[model samples]
Target chain A: MTAVLTTTAMPPAATAPTALRRALPLLAAPVAFFVAFFAVPMVVVLSSSLAAGGAPSLANYARVLLDQYHWDVLAVTFRIAALTTLAVTLLGYPLAYYLVRVVSSNALRRSCVILLLLPLFTSNIVRSFGWMILLGRNGLVNDTLVGIGLLERPVRFLGTEMGIVIGLVYILLPFIVLAVGNALATVDPTLEEASADLGASPFTTFWTVTFPLCLPGLIAGVIMVFTLAASAYVTPALLSGGKITVFPMLIFQQYSTVFDVHYGGALSITLLVFTLVLVALAGRIGNGGGDRS
Target chain B: MIARVVLRIVAWAVMAYLILPLVVIVGASLTATSYLAFPPQGLTLAWYGRMLADTSYVAAFGTSTALALAATAGAVLLALPAALAIARHDFPGKRTLLSLLMSPLVLPHVVLGAALLQYCAALGLMRSFAALLVGHVVIVTPFVLRSVLPQLTPEQRALEEASADLGAGPFETFLLVVLPQIRGGLTSGAIFAFISSWINVELSIFNTTAELTTIPVKLFNYVQYTIDPVIAAVSSITIAVAAVTIVLLDLTVGLHVLSNRR
Candidate 1:
């Protein structure tokens, strides 16, 4: 399939590079605009990060990297992201399976999909606001817990890492469901039946066959969730109630409040590098999963 | 059988988790009390009325709508041409160019937003609508490109070539042969672009002021210090917009994202 796509997708691979001029008009506007706004601004940030007092220096990096506070913020940021990824995967996979393989009613599936997309389509602010209301000391979750005698009194959640994790998980769950559901929908069920015919139990079939087939999509969704969760500012900020701070908040404070672009630039570049490295690593993992499948 | 039953319960619980928050916001919006309340202490639409009465909320809504619309239009206009070039033609450094165009997807908005705040400040464009629109276009254009590039398959390229060979002009070939086939991609891409722009807070936060804020930014600011029924009403409005958009997308393009089509 890959070979066929590569061949047919490219007509006459040896075709002349002279055809480039024909694309000039089409590429001119988009390329120019990206260069001006996107490329130049990013370059400015990179250069500014390397400069202090009108001379290129590593002082900014020393300030950002040499500090224990920045490191602590990064650790907290990644810990929340990791936890959110785990929770979303644990919760999203079963729902995706049910939606794709179990439910036979088209109307029900459609409604499920719309409901799933409701939070996705809504703004993160609004979604986090919902959580803010629910996870408050007197909010629904607390009220239910206390009412059910599960807790002596309302435990504080709004200013804790637990609150942020729940909010981040909610914000990111849809991506996993969409990713895994689409993958599950394409898995040939006959293969599972064939595995059963070969004297495999349901658990064995799922572990040896069914699971590997969708591993690539699962990895993609996980990468997306982790990256988004790691970079997320709004959900963490809202749910943290100004008590807990993450990496992005540091960057925002530097820029929006501190007005220190040099330090802010270093923070921004740090995030960009970390995010890009993770994506690259995950791409390799996803490709390996594809080969195994 | 036990596993199946457990899976059903878990799936239903997950769906409930997803719906609970939005329902709480909507229900709270209707409370007759000044404070937000779910199961709404005496149902009323007065909060929504209050939102309308507050000119700032009204202005923020208008700004958000107009900004989203303009950004979506800009993204489509920019990305359609770029996708055409990348998919329809083979050029030097095509892969690098494509990656550059799509890098915003991975780049954090806070980073990009800060970068723009600094860059625009140097160019005297800080806190301006132009600055916001440019950042939005950079981010959302990738959506348009990703959707449209797949539609411009080799077979579709062949059709374009065939039309040109059959004495059709370039504009005619694009308008007559290309546009109709990619309309679905365009619609889905545009909707995604518009919603992304509308919901954006990180990028807009740097550029928006009290008077120039988008709806999401306004609500974000309001929610931090205060949680009122009017805030619930405003949030409920965004949820409504999301629902309407999703329904429209389902009706028009068939949101078969999880279907077995691929």
Candidate 2:
């Protein structure tokens, strides 16, 4: 299969100069487009962040970093992101494992996968709107809880951290499922079978063999969920109901309402850098896990 | 065995959790009441009718459709060549270029939106369709690139070379041989790109005006100020569109995503 694949997929061997020249025409349009639109816009934001009062200054950074309000918002944002990632991983891992390793019916698994992708494909606004109605004071969730004696009265979900986390997890859960599902699918089941036949318990086999293999995918999903939950604007905006604020919301406020590009630029860069650093750390951790066991 | 049973129960519950909100929105949209309700007070299409009666809703839908179509087309045009280059030839900065294209997937759309707003304002094109198109293209191109790159394998290259050696020109070879091979990837990628552009809020919010808003951004703005059956109706329409797209996607490409097949 590998040899067949290579023969079918690989380009004809060509000299480096000729291949570079041939590839140039194809690369030109996309490279130019990204440089103009993506790269240049990012550069503009970076420059704006570094300048204030028509001079290059760190005032915007100081304002963003030194302010207590910003720190509070960052704490809320990161906390929500961290919690969302954890919740998604907990919920998603089992579903992925069931789908990949346990489920016997192909049709069932496909339907479940479709169900997973539907919410992902749908707009966050729409999904969050759904949650808003369901979580309202007299909504079905509260009604059911009260009816079942789970609560004495309707509990507030809107305008709270828990509400934000719920919405973010719902929006992000599919990433974890897909990532870990694909990873699970690639693991050789025979290894687990061998461990079992060699007198290891199922739990021991999983912890010693199966779990380590899928760590990369789990980490990828965790990073994706974290980044997405951290930067999520629409879900947090709707679910928070103006009572909670995340980092992206602050950035949006500065640009959309305050029209303070310098401050917003600083906020944008701060969020971007923070997300990048977390992602890097997660990658390192994932690699470390891969190296161990 | 007990653990397996537990896993099964948890999986089903998670599936329900995954689907409950969408079911509620679709249900609430049919409520006869002026306010939104699930297990809807009474079934009625009146809210959907009211939505249809509004010209702004109709216009926003039209604008969103046009923008998504344009962006998808632009992404396909730009990304296909880039995919071809990356798959067919090794070049300097190939890894960097691929990451640059795909970075939008991970970058915060809010930041991108704000950056575009600032950049376009500097370029004298703020809040225009052009500005929206460029931003949408930048973001959605990666979808097309990712999907198409994997389809361009060495075996496919051999077929293309065979067509060329048989005296077919580059364009003809691409049209007949290469296009057919990557049709699945390209179609799926284009659909994904279309939907991503269509349903985008954060990115579109920055460039959109009251006159030229997309459906998702419009819905975002409306849902903030009010929660009514009409809003639910609008949400349901988008939900229906998403449902249809997914169904079409499943039928066409076979969403065997969880299959343990290599």
Candidate 3:
């Protein structure tokens, strides 16, 4: 996930009294730039979401919250996101474990990491386009399934939730792998060794020792994946093929085609608030587990 | 041992899944057919040639490259100072300020794009190069800051002090000692920043005019209506660029990020 970009290392404990004055000048430009470009735009969106006819009102929110159609869209959006998260974690944890614990050759591990990042570095459009080709009625996926007699006919994946899930999982798998792989790498083998020496079976050792230690990273990765999957615009847009819609698609439609800033603002804020709330809850749960362990 | 076997199989299968789409795009690009084909009816680079002949594709590529370059430079300039300050000094709202700077990483780009469009329109900056550049810089600056902050360790601070004690000025100490120590991080962060800006679509889509669109956005509009070899060729170009960048990064900075030694 791009959150990898913001993951902090240790900050210095404290600084000299004079260091604050020296640092103030350095902080000024970036802070001012962010306030101007980043913070203010978000404020604009928030204000628009609340404004109706020049006064702050919840009319737009009522429109969004009252409509059954919007509810259906939100359901579909979160369904795909939850399913994507589940699938990616299932598929990603094993890969991360293999890369971190099983692969002994450093060169091979490096190669695997590169392969993991290649798709990530590519645009979402290109990646979803690849699926657009493969998940077509006559695409490779259906061809292989039919060839092997698993299906009597070509299955339609395009415009289906399954197609969207496949693409989202593909797009997001690397984030979980990186997050879990880093966590797995940091687990001391001696702890597991001690577990085995204490007569715990392999399964028990993994469940009680290894997995808990890496739970924080796993939770972080899940949050990143779920937030991204829920709010994703490009993948769902390209893969949904117009027969399906997600929440971000609704926001995009309002902003791009309808140019309904007020309504669009409400929709955007709705998605943002829900995502942040879910993330905060997840963070709390994760922290609680970490503290317990 | 049996469990290990199953894990290996699943892991390898997932790896193949990860590589399959990229291979398909590259393979489809080389097809001689007018339409896309997998094992490519026949091998030909004609689509790539056609893409090159189209000046719009060329222009979009040029615009995307220039935008990414400018954004990378801007992020480095803005983030390096911020990283130094956050690492070297404690001020009021330091944690609040740090989160504010990094908030773009988690915020939805679609919302950000829409917000920028609305906000920039108020300021008369919408749908221009500057608007696109600012949005790109905002999103990518966190990459530089994240990578650079860790390099400003207490050990490095000790080195900086030593340089100052040797009668070096602040600029001289930064240039001679601090800069050399953080060079690896700076390069890695800059590369990440460049790539993020280059491959961005959602944010750039709002601020891009027909004439000033990025490659991803161009391919996006074209792909929604059509699936041709030319689009594949264009996508293949971006994938190739990604591969080259990764190889370059691995060779230069050693992208062994999963190491336990940290």
Candidate 4:
């Protein structure tokens, strides 16, 4: 979560003078650990991405950017991610609100939380594999649709954008629910009550007061969903049935199948940069809303 | 009344959406069909038996368990010291250092996997258990650090100081005073770290070979080529493991992550 990233980004304050010296030794291990493992690998990736067949050139980037297939893949990736974010927010916010405000039973709320987190703990492969079964022809989804006379034929759910979206929404919905639920729980009920007391209707109270307060959580969830959905490889790979492609699929293909680290590095760097940019923008929006609130 | 009804309907529908895949997987694993069938022609545990019978599945499970355990332990050891440093210290570029350590959470794992693969190949450690373990540790450390750092409050520091003043050595203070206070965080973090490593496919996929694969990666490879009850059985076992872990976490730390509690 961004909690780890944001916590790490805190500007060092020279408030505790004597303790600073005491903490120096403690810092050595983590700093060294990161430098050796995290930073060096990243540097290797960057260097590899830039170096193309023993010469530094933008040819890899040129190939990535100029390729029509890469564009289509990137388009598919972002389209699915954006749609998944929208769907999860729409579905998750209400559920979060319901859990926060409507569900009064402590046991029920706890159960819902557990249900939400169960998929998160499961492997993406397992989750997507579940969808692969359900979304296939003669799967439960098709059987139910046919039984209900909703379809003349079994709708192809596997290896489609819709299939990928469904899997992603399932995978990422918990983030939105948790984020919005936390924000909703912290909202002052009195403010909504006051709005009602001032002749506002319940809907108006929710829209004018409650919704604004939970916006940060909603935004946070959206950003997390966006970034994760964008980068997700396993779900799309499984659900896509090898017929559909996303940006991560390209990176995976390059590294795994082609064994082309240089081209794979370029693709990986592209996705990483784009994802980071989107996340940064989302953070800015969330922080801006936080300040306004 | 209409509004309330609509909200209830939407909430229930969303809940169904969330639970649908999991239900199907568990159900399919119980099917008598050689191939996966959702409404599961007839209930049977033969698939589970088949999964258990496979040596590769068993080996992958063993490897995943060992890797997750080792990675979680390494993350805790590394993160505990790091958390103390970040929470209690004031150092130049500390923020950057922290971000570098924690950036793996947001950075694409496929990218990290590729990078680590490339990096390890240079050092002659590619496709080995060591290469995989180090990658897993890097990704999982942030979980422990994030969870543990928040627990090291000024109040906790005051308690640590008190322990030190009471003739407790540094190690004794950490063991008796600091650790107990952060035990919940450490436990939750370690659980999360372990689960993250267990569920990992991206990083592990890069380092895992046919002979040395994790369960998830193995399933990933198999599911691509075949869709059978055995794969369902493997997937179901993982789902069951995940369910057990969640229940354990719920019982231990309480999974009311979004409850209206301070």
Backbone clash count, each prediction separately? 0, 8, 0, 0
Candidate 1 lDDT, B23-104, residue by residue in tens? 9999999999888887789989888888899999999999999999999999999999888878766789899999999888
Give the runs in model 1 whose Cα sits over 4 Å from its true position.
A1-16, A285-293
Please report how far candidate 3 places residue A23 from its true position, in Å.
2.5
DockQ of each: 0.58, 0.60, 0.57, 0.57
Checking candidate 3 for backbone clashes, the offending pairs are none
DockQ of candidate 3?
0.57
Residue-by-residue lDDT tens digits, candidate 2, A145-225: 999999999999999999999888899999999999998888989999999999999999999998998888898888888
lDDT of 1 by residue, A119-155 (tens): 9999999999999999988899999999999999999
Candidate 1 lDDT at A103 equals 92
lDDT by residue for model 3 over B1-262, one digit each (tens)?
8999999999999999999999999999999999899979999989989999999999999999999999999999999989988986777678898999888889999999999999999999989999999999999999999899999997998888777668776776678998999999999999999999999999999989899999999999999999999999999999999999999899889886777665
Highest DockQ model number: 2
Would you list the C-alpha lDDT of every candidate in the order shown?
0.90, 0.91, 0.91, 0.87
True contacts kept of each: 0.73, 0.78, 0.71, 0.72
Candidate 2 stretches greater than 4 Å from native: A1-17
* iRMS of candidate 2, Å: 4.2
- Ranked by DockQ, the better of candidates 2 and 4 is 2
Tens-place lDDT digits, model 4, residues B62-88: 999999999999999889988887876
Model 1, docking class: medium
* Candidate 3 CAPRI grade: medium
Candidate 2 DockQ, CA atoms: 0.60
